[model samples]
Target: MVSFGDSKFVKKVCGITQASYQHGWDERNGGNVSLRLTAEDLVGFDDVSEVKRTLDLGFDAKVLSGSYFLVTATGRYFRNVISQPGLDLGLVKITDDGQHADLLWGYEDGAKPTSEFPSHLMSHIKRLKVDPEQRVVMHCHPTNVIALSFTHELDERSITRLLWKMQAESLVVFPEGVGIIPYMTPGTNEIGKATSDKMSEFRTVIWPHHGIFGTGDDLDEAFGLIETVEKAAAIYSQICAQGGEIRQEITDEQLGDLAHAFGVVASPKFLS
Candidate 1:
């Protein structure tokens, strides 16, 4: 049997957490990540069904019952994940009843999953409905994206158009555009439901003045989605700092051509 320590999933979690910290996206424990896992992924791990403990999820996850997830622990700094994966990450299986999660491995120091687990789970549930391959949910405070929340209009259509024009790759990376949710207290069912609802139509959702929730089929895809938006936000920030005047930017027609070339459908509502 392969030890959990040597599992690829564990390594992936650790690597992403380290990268997030290095990029200044997850200061302290300000962000969280959760990756849905299939039974095939746990084939080599012994005692996969043994529950070390149970945690109340505060929301029913019946739809995800019997599924497994690897998530960063609550209050655990991303900076420490690479060096101490066992203490900063955990493997949990949603109980059949859906009211609790059974700890299967990791979180060796008795840490719990991130406070945003509900949001992550909700997102996972919603995304999977749209794309069966969906497997990852990542939340982080990208400096520029959060800054844009303060200076840019909160309307999803406006924010989507602005980010699409800020960089050439914006439309391709997030062709469906981004979702925006007004400021709300984090780690609650209300926020989770709001974010999840957005996930039904968008792969990325920005929590105004907070952070972003990105979903994808894997860690890199999810992280890249957030990274692309954040980079576009940063470019917009630089443009504003230079004068807040647009001399030239990607036009709607040009955006259409680019989207056509990429074979991706840019959000129609934002286009002329």
Candidate 2:
């Protein structure tokens, strides 16, 4: 429950993530999104009224804590998704002493914390800077993206290259590089490593047959890149299935520009 910055933008991003989540794309109970927001407490419940205000403005507060909330909840079937009005949600708020965040309340049905809660917490407090003003993380399992990770015959490196070519923005934003972690059981320590290791080099990481974990300064930008990556993968899957080669690819220089636009970290020398 380390305190991080907050943002109204996160609420906006959560709204978008919820739409994608409930639409049968990320899979019911398969994807997760965590957003950091301005800290109201070193560790305390976020003003529930303010949370309500954000929701009134059409933000989704799935795992609302004090200053942070997860966009998705745990335990509910994706079909019976608790995505509507007046739904109860639980969150862990950081206490004022800068010690820890405690569980505040339960959403309708008294939902418990998500199994990926540790990952969410770590992403916010431990791994990367999960401040609201700085980062929004969305993790999902789009079918095509997950499908690419399950195969034995496909060249992993080549898969990303082809997908990036399909959407030039990916090549730039993720230009430092994308990574593939060997499969690990969902919500396990191993999976956390899979996520943590790639945090520095790439903003998004794919979990084979599982889902995607993405982060960014803004929520839409982060999630949008993921959608692009997913769409590109979908196209590549279709083309490769037809036994045809990808028709075009962006040069490394073009990728550099894309990364710069996204505010991705670059080596000191590259800055000059």
Candidate 3:
């Protein structure tokens, strides 16, 4: 008897979108989120039996054939998700051929998945290969992160180091470092592929001058990754606004020590 609006996944993602919007991260329809679903997660949903509609994915998602996802809808605003989950979200099952998806629930007004759905799927496929337990792929436009994107070098190593130095826990939380892709048009296969390539080694990817993509075993982990990075970026921005006077900062050796203390190996590729 669980309705679409009553589902926990629906509630969680919607709440996240609302939080993102309230935090001023997702403006308008600028950000989207997708969470892979398991059979158990859909157990109580009585309306998922048949396809409500079908939409082309525009890219091969065969690796995810038969998989189910609860995702935001196209042109939907995050602020309204919690208030109207049925209209702002949808559950889709990847078609057998992977070129399409069958909408099973929600999207009340016939809206489709986010235009960035391809990117979400692409990153999901790559991240799953990297960590089979991975289940969430989130993208958002955090103001501070976008600001850092312009103020900081677009190089992955440099940004990684900068974020790690900005906070003691940065290296521990993202030991593999963050990946950065060249700015390209969003919602395209090309951007999707580039982000997928980065996902091969990093759980977090930065879309320079745009936003960020984060993957994790669950919703909180995915959101946490992005949250941590955003916080670091905020600190960096404030430092600049305050005259860029740095009496001190975390040193490389200290970062190594912190990583060892946390038992997560910092990326040697990024660390000096």
Please, what is the whole-model Cα lDDT of each candidate in the order they appear? 0.92, 0.55, 0.90
Candidate 2 TM-score, true structure as reference: 0.70
Instruction: List TM-scores for all candidates, in order.
Output: 0.98, 0.70, 0.98
Tell me the deviation in Å of residue 100 in model 1: 0.7
The CA root-mean-square deviation of candidate 1, after full C-alpha superposition on the true structure, stands at 0.9
The TM-score, computed over Cα atoms with residue i paired to residue i, of candidate 1 is 0.98
**How would you encode candidate 1's per-residue C-alpha lDDT over 1-272 as one tens digit per residue?**
66786888889988998899999999977899999999899887785668898999998999999999999999989999999988888899999999999999988889999999999999999999999999999999999999999987899999899999998999999999999988999989999999999999999999999999999999999999999999999998998899989999899999999999999988788877
Which is better, 2 or 3, measured by lDDT? 3
Task: Tell me how candidate 3 scores on lDDT.
Answer: 0.90
Q: Which residue ranges in model 1 land beyond 4 Å of their true spot?
A: none
Write model 2 residue lDDT over 159-263, tens digit each, in one string. Answer: 566565667665655554455676788776557755766665566777777777777777777777687788777777888798867555566566567666777
Say which candidate scores most in lDDT.
1
lDDT-sorted candidate list, best first = 1, 3, 2
Ranking by TM-score: 1, 3, 2
- Candidate 3, residues 1-272, lDDT tens digits: the string is 65766878888997789888988989988889999998787876678987899988898899899999999999989999999998989999999999999999999898999999999999999888878899999999989999988877798889899899999978988999999999998888899999999999999999988999999998889888999999999999899999999899999899989988989998889889
> Cα miss at 177, model 2 (Å)?
2.6
